[model samples]
Target: MNLLDHIASVAALAGRPWHDHAALAADEHLRFEWYRDAVPRDEIAFLRLVLADPDREMAISAVLARIDERARSSIDFHSWADRVEPVCAPVEFLSRRLAEWRLLIDAFAGRPVEDAAVLAASDWAQRKLAAVVDGDLLVLLAEHGRTRRVRALTRVPRPARPVRLSDRAVTSGPIRPCYG
Candidate 1:
């Protein structure tokens, strides 16, 4: 899917030149496609997932790690997608995309490959995702309601374990369902 390709593209940037603070206006290093499409969809879908199964944290983190592995792999996206398409039935692909977004954000924040902070970031990310879904109303306020936004962000619990993103996690390992 386009989201996967975008993740691969952004993940590849881990090896590219870094830009100055003045150069990044929105604090987002990802492509415009991510902002236009994936971000909201990701939040909504993930919120729905959390609402459905709040206890699936371990499984979600594991799947997200696998996704980060895939995005960071050297293999072509379509080729890998084709191979795993069969194994990833129903909602597997969707979850994989969400995982990609999360890891991509982390990598840009200097948490690439493997970072201990990411271990703790997972919890925060989860809480943040849940808050956005639960507090969608606050988002309608002017300027996205700065006070409300901070409240939402501050309330998010930090991650217990950061999702792992290895250099060759996918290409060197057995391909399997990256369900989140």
Candidate 2:
């Protein structure tokens, strides 16, 4: 589907009304090209609104992907970066970092983790990445990730253990975590 159609569909999913494309566009450059290209200005406001709702992030991300594909092909990205300073740096850095990390992930796939090495590497990477992507954001993400892992681990049933009496051993119930 074309960009506006995709935008409309996402907006519809969010129960948002169609908005004018002109208002939602990034700048006059994009707007002028949109007009020059005979792009319709009606019914595409969800681009702005959906950004405010976390639930629509995936859909918006898809739309942004399409927009990115189009923008890279049609617009002067460096010019846009000049207007929106620091725009390209994070994306460029993260893209490079993600590529680097993907190789590590692939190498580690299906392999047993070496805990001490993995922990040390993770600590170093987290510290480095925090410098690039804000320290507090990394902390919040790490905390969330740890919480999820802990919760998942807590839910798994442990094998039953034996309780010993004076002369007999009896199997006890599955051990579960006691969470405060």
Candidate 3:
């Protein structure tokens, strides 16, 4: 599937809505123009609702659980990353990180976690991702959880991929002809 469809599928899984083409493009300049052009306006509005709210981490997780359920009832997450460019990394990262944050918040708020439970959670949260899109998302999420206070959760930065030369588009440049 194409990127938008992939994102929609994942969002469908995560139960989070995405932004409309105009709104998404408004927020992020690089959305595929042709794809954006084709999406319906109401869908875009629904997408806007998903993108607009930052307080919906729990809701997003619920959506992801649904997506996971669908996958389990059928197939594995094949091409999971490519299917949801940018969105997958962010959602995956956010979901794991939010869960980690919940633990930390519990700890700080004096809620107790069994030592084994904390270790297991940390291990799961800090595992390195293998896919290109999911690369290090889990680790970063864990790190984010470790570094911040619960009250500062809203201020956490979104996941970012490292710049790779291979991912760049090539453009022509002026060149002089070589002498024979």
Cα lDDT listed for each candidate: 0.39, 0.38, 0.40
Candidate 1 Cα outliers beyond 4 Å, as residue runs: 1-56, 92-180
Judged by lDDT, which candidate is best?
3
> Candidate 2 lDDT, tens digit per residue, 96-129?
3333343233233433333333233444343433
List the lowest-lDDT window of 10 residues for candidate 1. 134-143
Root-mean-square deviation of candidate 1:
23.2
CA displacement after TM-score superposition, residue 129 of candidate 2 (Å): 21
User: Candidate 2 at residue 37, lDDT?
Assistant: 34
TM-score of 1: 0.22
State the lDDT of candidate 3 residue by residue for 1-180, as single tens digits.
Answer: 444464465345344455453454343322333222333333333333343333345335433443344334433333332233344345565445445544444444455544444444543332311111122332343444343432133244546778686786765885458899
Report clash pairs, candidate 1: 118-162, 119-161, 119-162, 120-159, 123-159, 124-158, 124-159
| Per-model TM-score on C-alpha atoms | 0.22, 0.21, 0.25
Instruction: Name the better of 1 and 2 by lDDT.
Output: 1
